[model samples]
Target: SQKIEQNSEALNIQEGKTATLTCNYTNYSPAYLQWYRQDPGRGPVFLLLIRENEKEKRKERLKVTFDTTLKQSLFHITASQPADSATYLCALVSGLYGGATNKLIFGTGTLLAVQP
Candidate 1:
């Protein structure tokens, strides 16, 4: 089994501020890391993906960075709002070089609460 660590407590942020979350894994190496947003009672929605070879990737209002050396990934959301309040998860495919045979493992997830 794969285990990744995220913030055990919910992160509270003010509206229009930038919220950053961290994911760290101690066991396995991943070819890529992905970020997702999940609302209560809803499936996770894909947000970003950063490969091991890539340093960073960004989407509107969101940015993700992957650091293979540190076995960590950081997710950032700028100008965050109440709508951005949700559980953010980090995931990766467990295999050498992320082949199709690899299974995806998701981190425990960190909840972000944006206050307006």
Candidate 2:
């Protein structure tokens, strides 16, 4: 019954602006959350990992917030440029039982388009 959803539309914006994206979920209590960036035809690169107890996390130009009560997470990219354009993925991780794998479940990503 666990599910994740990100914006399906491509976000088009001018360079040097901030890009904000949303991720919503239902029916799951995750221990951790992660954000990743993926280019076309390539695997995702980890950007940030936040625990359920953490309210906010930041790294360089990126920031993320988790709300376990609402089952949602938000991703933000400040001072974004054309080079920052890509698909962003939000993932949720839960503790697995014995002999099981602790894996991150990914949402369908949001494509960002930065215009110069």
Best by lDDT: 2
Candidate 2 residue-wise lDDT, 1-116, digit = tens: 77899999999999999999999999878888899999999999999999999999999999999999998999999999999999999998755645378788899999999999
lDDT string for model 1 (21-65, tens) is 999988877888899899999999988989899999999999999
Runs in model 2 deviating more than 4 A are: 94-100
TM, every model: 0.93, 0.93
Cα lDDT, all candidates = 0.91, 0.91
